[model samples]
Each structure stands twice: as structure tokens, then as C-alpha cells.
Target: MQNGRKQIAVWDVFVRLFHWCLLAAVLISFYTTKTDGAPFLFPIEVHAQAGYIIIGLLIFRVIWGVLGPTYARFSTFVYGPKNTASYAKALLKRQEPRYASHNPLGGWMVVLLLLSLSFQAVSGLFLSDDIFFQGPLYGLLGRDVSGELASLHALNSDLLLILIGIHLVGIVVHALLGEHLVPAMVTGIKRFTSAPVDEKPAYRTKYRLLAIGAFLVAAGVCGWLWFYPY
Candidate 1:
């Protein structure tokens, strides 16, 4: 606390790393998938690799959401439907309460984004272009089933684009309200004019070891997925 402002840690290192990595994976996957033979586009192998990485990132995130720091834990941010609806109403009036962690609406958005990405990644595992590229699980399922999953995968990708657009719009809205949402995410620090003098202490533990272990497990899973076809 200094000069009538208190700096609080809102995102830990793992959370920040996960956020940017997932964003890059999603963007790379999108570009590769959409630009099949176009100039300056990555090969389909890159797209498939990105999808595998997304699977690992999602797995690590689900685990971390349970065992991570104060603001990173799912229990600290997820709210009930009633509370979410109330927050939505407040947003319409531009009077929503400022939260140290994710606001209620943003919490739900996070859940939706994670779920959407998970669906896309899983479905991609069984997809096939029938010409040059095929997913790792493409042979396990019959052609018809794989085709259906591929259709769903393409549809979900469109939904993901729409969701991303909405997320950007929300960022703009927050910016208009004088909240530096993007910067806070990048720096992991949120400054408050007057923080609680005796707020509950952060949950401290050997988080570095835990993060390393989780990352190793995720990487191992991804490696298995990548090489299982060979």
C-alpha cells in the first residue's frame, strides 16, 4: 500500500503464462486451419500441433483452477446464475461493482471460452480432411462419425470467433469505464484506491513445485498425443 493506493496480485505467473499461450495457440490454429494452401500460411501439421497444445493447456488450467492462488482459484470467481444475472443488469447501467478478481459476467465468459476451446480441441482429434491431413483419433472412429465430428469442429470454430469478438467488445467497454483490464492481465497487478487494511492473506504454498509438476504432466500428455499416431 502506498500513496492511498494498494497494489494487489490478481494473477500468478502460471495464470498469466497460460492466458497468453492459449491465445497464441488459438490464433495459430485458426490461421493454419483457415488458410489450407494459401501463401504465407503454416502447414496443417502446425494446426494439428496447436490443437494438441491447447489440450494440454486446458488440462493444466483445470487442475490449477482448483489448487492455484487466491484470485486464480475457480471458487473465488465463479458465481451463481442469480448473481451473474444481477451483474449483467448492473453492467447495462454502467454501475457494476469493481472486483479484485474477474467480475461475475467475465467469470462466466471464461468458463464458456474454456469449454468452447475444449470442445474444438477434442473434436479436432477425430477430424480428417480426407486428402492430406487427419487427426490422431481419426482411424479409431469410422469415417461417418469422424466426418460428423469434423463438421461440429468447424461449427464450433465459428462460434469461437464470435465469442472472441464479444470478448474484445467487452474489453473496449471496460476501457471506456476507465478499467485497464488488459494491462492488469498482462502485469498481474490491480491497483485499488483503498484496499482493505486487513484483507485475508493470500494462500501461500510451494506453488512453484506444483506448477512445474502440472506442466510436466501436461507436456507428457501432449507428447503422447503428438506421437501416438506414429
Candidate 2:
């Protein structure tokens, strides 16, 4: 249960909240999209609202990566492809080291998933089904452009599914190897074997302010997507 002599503040509370919120939003969106024929206003309204909520959570995540805790920042783990290859090789050899934060390969997966989902959200902003919700950007485009964007948006959703699969599999592998990676994300505590003993922790008050600001921006954007259309 313990790996080192010291405890490190790995992930913050807001980061965990955002992660779970995004997961819920994705599940709601999936259910609504998949069961459109069901006779229920709950699914209809919830799906539309959940889509916007997912976008909002993503906005918070991107902002948090820049201005949150040390382990929560992108700069802490976004390594180059070479580093990923080396990490991958180590992983294959069962020699990869556990990190208190995201390892290099895992870190880029975070970036890739976020970026791909960001594109999905951006495309969703312009998508309208004439069924449930009308995207604000729908009015600005002609039928052809709107149609093309809609198709891309539909196809891009599959990418999110694929990315989710990869992420889940990685977590499962870690679990099977006796590593509690998921709990680390949930509880923000991780065990690492080789860290030094007397490292000082730096505290920051700006992170709370940054997370709050991002959450507000996310709320505003999601509200606009739900209630307003151009």
C-alpha cells in the first residue's frame, strides 16, 4: 500500500470531479443518442443537456491542465514520441516504473483523448439534428456545410469510443499487475517505488481560483449550448 517514506499530493479534488463528470456526461449522451426512438422526454432533454455538460467538463479539464496542481498539469507528463516508445518498450518488458503522476505514455493518452474529444465538442457545436437541439453554428452554415460537419461529428464520436476502450484496457492491465491506478485517479494518492525521501511540497492557492474560473466558463458555455442558438 505504501511505496515511499513520504506522501505526495498527486491529484486535486477538482480534477477528480471533472473526470467523473465527463464520464457521466458521455454515458448520458451515449444513451440518448442510442435510444432516440424511446418515448421519453427525460432521455431527450438529458441527452441534449449532457452533451453540453461534457463540453463544459472538457473546458474545465483543459484549463486545469494549465493552471492546476503539479501532477495535474500537462507539462508534468506530456513527453515526446521517443519517450513514449521507450516507455512502451519498458511496459512490454515489464520493466516500466510507476509514476506518482501520469507516466509519459499515459500522459499523451490524456492529451490525445482530450484533443480528440475537443474536436468532437467543437463539431457538436455546429451540429443540429432538427430533432432535439440546434447547434448555434447551424444557422451560420448552408445545408451542404452543415451536412458535412454533421457527418464528421457523427464519425468522430466513434473515436471517443475507441479512446475509451484503450483507456479502460490500460487501467485493467495496471490492475492485473497489482497497481491501483484507478484508485489513484479517484483518490489522488499513488504509490511509487523509487522516489526520494525528503522532497518538499509546494502549495498553491491560485489553483483553486483557476479551477473555479474554468468551471464557471464551462457552465456559461454549456448554458449557451443548451438555451441559445444563432
Candidate 3:
């Protein structure tokens, strides 16, 4: 937590990059759906490109949530059922402790959102619009299987809307309570507390070359899956 412009790094560069990339990918994908069949450069490539980026970000995120900074790692926020229930109770009473990172309930929400988005990404690889935009992984499944996966993908995406709405509501509630959680994520700086909720420990930092390498390799795979069509 920062006190009067004190710098405490809560988010690594990789984390911030992944966050923005995923946001862009999701927005592009939704836009393409809204404007499907529009004629432009390549005439229908943006959604496919966006899907590849979404998957890449999701892969990077899963790896980072396991091995990133102290505040970013899963172990930092993932809590037991008791903690989640306690947080819920506190929220009802308007007394939930504000965490510099994710709170227990919010932590589970993060997990759920990640899992749901990942599932949607994977299923997207195997889904078609039932008309055009058939995925390259379409061959791995029979017609019936592809249809089922497409349905699952749509179902998951619909659920994501509800979850995101809930998250925005939570954010607004926190802001109303004078806790600027959204800025902490955007600026990677949390406001200070007298009782010290969690100490900001500066960990020796370096990007995992292997992760970046693997990401490039995944880009290769994405190309193969999108363009080369096995």
C-alpha cells in the first residue's frame, strides 16, 4: 500500500500486459460478432485473430496466476470455504475487510472468471457459428460433438455476462465505501492502512523467458490452427 505517493508495486508488467490484452481480445471478439459478414480488410479475420489473442492471454494468465508476483499469485488470495462465507457475511453487513489484493469472495470470483473464460476460449477453438467461422479444431470432433461444444461455448459466454455485471456492482459498492479498488488494479498501488493488512514485499523480479518462449510457440500454434487448418 502506498502512503502519500509511496510506490509499492502490486502488479508486474507481464500481469498488466496480460490484463489489457485479454480485455482487447474479448472486446474485439464481441464486436466481430456484432458486425459479422461486414466487408473489410481480409473481410472476416478480426474475430479469428481476436480468439487467438484471447487464448494466448489466458494461457499466460494461468501460468502467471501460479508463478507471478506475491500479490498476483493464487495462493495469496485463494481462501477456504469459511473465509469465502465470512466475506459474504461481512459484505452483507457492509463490514468486509478491504484487501490490497483480492478478498476471499473476490478471489473465488477471479478463479471462476478465469476458468469460465478459458473454457470459452478452448471451446471456441472447436466451435463454428453453425454457418461460417468454423474453427480449425473442428476436424477433431464429429458434427454432433462440434455442435455440443458450440452450445457449451455460447452458454459459458452468457454466464460470463452475469458474472461481469456482478463484479462491476461489487466494484461500485467498494468505491461507494471509499475504497478505490479499481485504481489499485489500474495503477498497481493500494492505499495504506494503519493496521497493516498485508505488507508489500518487493520480490526479486524477472520475466520467465520460458513463459515468453512458450507464448511465442503458442502463437505458432495459433497460426497453424487459424490459417493452415490441419
Best by lDDT: 1
**Candidate 3 Cα misplacement greater than 4 A, ranges:** 1-7, 35-44, 208-214, 217-221
Question: Candidate 1 vs candidate 2: which has greater TM-score?
Answer: 1
**Cα TM-score of candidate 3:** 0.85
lDDT of 3 by residue, 142-179 (tens): 88898998788778878987887888887897788776
Each candidate structure's TM-score, on Cα atoms with residue i matched to residue i, is: 0.92, 0.88, 0.85
Candidates in order: C-alpha RMSD to true structure = 2.3, 2.8, 2.7
lDDT of 1 at 66: 88
RMSD of 2: 2.8
Q: Give candidate 2's TM-score.
A: 0.88
Candidate 1 similarity to native, TM-score? 0.92
How many clashes show up per model? 0, 0, 0
Model 3: worst 10 consecutive residues (lDDT sum): 35-44
Error of 1 at 215 (Å): 0.5
Sorted by lDDT, highest first, which candidate order results? Answer: 1, 2, 3
